[model samples]
Target: MNKFLLTFKDSKIEKDYQENKLNTLQKPIFYWLLVMSFTLNLLKVILDYTYYTVNNQSWMNVGFVILVILELFLACYKKQYIKYALIISNLSAGLLQINFDESNTFPQEYYSYGSYYAMLSVVVYFMTDFPYSVFQVFIHLSMKIFFTTIKSHRIDMLGIILGLITNVFLVLTLYICDWNSRRQFLLNLREVRWEESLPFIIKKPFYLFTYKDKNMSFQVNRAYNQDFFPYYNQEDCCGCNFRQFLRKCKVENNNLEIYLFDKRNEKLDFDLVYQNKTHKFDIRVCAIGLDQINYLIILEKLKLLTTSYIPKQTNLRQKIFQIKKTQIKYQHQKHFLLGVFSMFLYNNKEITSINLVDVLQKFSSRYFIISKSKIHIVYSDRSIYQLITYKHQLIIYLIQLFDCLINNQADPHSGIKLLLNQGLYAIRLKIYLTNRLKFQEQYKDNFFIQEIERNILSEEIDERLEISFLKKVRSAETSI
Candidate 1:
């Protein structure tokens, strides 16, 4: 009981929990209370009418009947205005029963309408919060005292004592109900927060939940759960035991990378292997700081070298050709940028001996279509030109060759300009950049892609594309 009362001492937590409980239970409570109010008040009106008719009495019975009828209508018809309905129904019922009692008697409990106030007190406590229920109890108690004094033409000690006992019971019951509601709310708080934060939970594969402490070496008491690990309850620990790992690795911060060579049974003592012929992984660790000592660690496994599994039936030519075809096909499938560049001799009126197929095969190793104006290249998964040094240099050479054609009175339509225009180049760049940004953002979890992105790009391509595309357009316009 003392513990329960202590909960109310922290008014903020109590109020917060109370409001949460009310929000969760309000709809069901609303319906239940409405039904009870309608049934009870309807009975009250009927009883009052029958009594009045039998006795051939008037004022007090008529008033009680009218008030009960109002309560019934409020409960039935004015349901949407529930707060007002609850207040009016509870208040009106208690007041009418007290003021308009049939017996002109001291101590209203002995009268016909005595039990009505006590019943209404129960309803008030259940359907509303403590303060409001307490308010109603006080009002009912005060009215009972006032009425008893007036009826006896003196202060009735017995009636006052009974009212005080009833109010005490009501108050205690209200507190207990509220305390239970708060306890239930606290029990479901974690689940409620988790449900509300689905987006955060879905993205975070490994969640490190810990409690911060003042006495410990680390500010947090590390509570490890295996559920977040990829292979939960498996033989491979995957370095999940952070407490042990921290001691062995001599870690300063949350970021720690340790490579373990799994040799099926035996442990390697040297930790060094020649010619990259070992089962080794470059593990990258990135920690996201959540609190003082509580953090989320993202572990990435990268295989530097591995033995290739080859088919026994397939020869070297078949394997080489298959790999080449797969690379080209993948490039074609994920093509994000397409550029057209044509080549022609400086003094030639027309292409007499320039075989398009030969040029594409000899100069650019990538598959391309030879149009009348230029050789078209599609940058699918990446800039294939950037991968081959000669290919990049060859493109520059071809552009220069075409420029020489312009100087040598060659056809105006036979160059890079004929293949692509300024506006078209800008639009294509935008489309390419947008698609590439979207693609990178999609598969950024892959280790190889992250490595490539980190090494090859100065700034984030997506950021550059979005931020500097306009500047590129301006430069393109100026060049044009």
Candidate 2:
């Protein structure tokens, strides 16, 4: 019941119609209004010349002719404000012409009263806004009643009752029907817009988009916001629209809409000009979970990054990632052991995550890896260049710390010192031990000769692998 009484239940829908639909429908509605008013005036001219012309209303007929010509001129006018002013004036004049006449011609008879109904129907159709249309009608209806009482010097109850009933039925039916139709159209349009956007949103672009973080490195669309987009295409454009940002940054390589996706941990500069003002943004590509990544775009005004951020960002990134030293010491009375072994492997053999187990297999003894880092190495009292220590002895010492308390030693936490390094976890430690896999009896000259033989053998393997030009290129850079 409330929905019918009020054409639109939501104020947002009314706002949408005004903001979106009004400009689109403006010219067409104006043209239609012009045609209808022209036709009605033409019909009135024929009636006046053929039938009878009232002596008192002669000035009104001449005024109607001038107004019709003005309406025709307004139909060609481009400005909406001018066209609207003309429409309101014309409607007001038509209402006054009907009201200030003799009782038989306009107030009581079917012919003049029929024109009254025609005028109202045009008002309802032209001004589809329910509340405004009803407001206009209320003012007109009250004015007509006041005119009737003034002319007859009495209140005509029957006539007012008839006028009220006709108005209620006419305004409600036409306005509600029109609003409902437009409402459904808007709803269908919204659904279609979602369906169109689904393809781009399938990827992880929209969710993690933010601006102005130093750690932003997800993607760089070919040249983001290199072109100017027009402002008044109903576009309330903002940087928050991640999919639109991606689309705007798109370029066509060999196929359709290809975007540059950079997975490095870095910040990308994205510039956009909106509403005649330039905006500088910083975007960070960071991982949301293990599987998906988010791009953060921060506005420069909010975050306050200077112009020299680009050159200094490298040094800044290094500072962010610079490993801080962490020291941890544990002492146990239980006999703790430490050992270091100097192993000579083939020079060309590189230990990596993929071939770790495989390369360890190449060694003569079973060398279990505690851990290793590309930028970090271990140091011990005996030897380095593959140092073996209690660092790999996880299984033996796993439960010994807590179990020492159960054994009730005098000071289980005192003698044996456990070493720790924050840069390389549980790996780099200082300890005293005898070196294994090294013959102490052998002279230093003998150990040097063994290292030379391993180097020559590894070089021979490399020569065998690089047989052709294609093989050399492929081996030099696997990514190429």
Candidate 3:
């Protein structure tokens, strides 16, 4: 009874229909049917050319066939107009055939068309929907039966009755087959839907899901959302409000009461805490039924990376370089600026690059020699490295660089090449420097950091540095 009346009794099938999910297999079959329709209509016109012309109905057949051909052409490209094309073609062709051989009416050619309703049902079966198709089938069958009875002047249009039975049987067979087809289609469609987004569910993973049900406060129809969602449950965790799972995961943020009732906001701001990172999401409340609403929260990770930067009148690089002279404290200090490894030294202050940062404390006329080109200075209050370099140009470069770190008028170019450590690339200026808070943040980088740190530029610390380092350590020990 259900199949006869409603072709798709399954809720999922109905949903797939609403979503317009045509399976891959359906396309080739539909196109083939369209071609077959065009060819058959054209062939009939060609074969019955004499007959139509003799009756002076040649233009009528030509125009009617052209309409079907035009409709089929449109249907091949534009899917939305297909149902109308199918309906129009089926009815028009059937009605035209009615007078063709009115005397020779049979079950196969019921006064004269090959079960138009049955053919319509077959095409409908290939479509993405069923309710409209079923209604159309019912109306068509009913009209055919009524017309047949009126023309025959008897209630026994048993041939049309047989056609109706064939259509119903065909629908029943399709309904049964649709059980699996709908399931596969839904699974594939769902993956495609979420797998594609922020507008889709790709970038933002589902944080929470709630649908209203009187028996159950709500139902959780969550995907395996552990990747984006902070909270993970082994079971269906339904409750009031959206963040009920947050409480279960021991998240202490307030408003975690989780509303069981449906809310009507398409884009409400929501927050999530997963992997100890706080994320903001858009709450999409989609009501499925009058009492049933589905809440899907997705975490937009890109919002952070793509956040609009506050436009400033001055650029960042220019502002950073333009330090206030008052804050600089240049004080005409003749400090050694280690010019090796792209490192910037203030009387040993802050430096950042894409290399080793050698921060040194107060010292004067220090001879720091890595090479004629290398200025490796790693000095601290705890572990001080003293340099003794005799190079005149190196001395000038160091003095100029030290001034550059603090003074506004100091030249950054100073006619020298530089390389700083990425730690990324983390090498050692000193053990104390390695343990600093700034370095600790990225201490967990690749294994290359520890390797690079163990060996800071093999050629930079050669014979000159070894001798200088030895002498300084000895002097420090004696002073201590």
TM-score (all chains, Cα) for each model: 0.36, 0.34, 0.36
> lDDT-based ranking, best first?
3, 1, 2
**Candidate 3 lDDT (Cα, whole model)?**
0.40
**Ten-residue segment with the worst summed lDDT in candidate 1?**
467-476
Q: Of the candidates shown, which would achieve the greatest TM-score relative to the real structure?
A: 1
Leading candidate by lDDT: 3
lDDT of 1 by residue, 209-254 (tens): 2323443322222223322222222223434444433333323332
Q: Which lDDT tens digits does candidate 3 get at residues 218-274?
A: 455554333333332223243332344544432234433343232343333445434
Clashes of 1: 2
Model 2 over residues 1-480: C-alpha lDDT tens digits? 145444445687656665454556655665565566567666666666777655335456556656667765765564545435444653455454343346336435646665765665455445545555565566666866886687669999998998899878877776766667676667666655653563354322223332234644323322222111211111223332344445444333311012335332343334432211112323332333222323433222212112322224444335323312222233321221221011212122332222212222222022111111011122232211231121222212222211222122233223222232221111222211122112122212332222222211111112111100000101111110
Error of 2 at 400 (Å): 74
Report lDDT per candidate: 0.40, 0.38, 0.40
Ranked by lDDT, the better of candidates 1 and 2 is 1
| Winner by TM-score between candidate 3 and candidate 1 | 1
Candidate with more favorable, higher TM-score: 2 or 3: 3
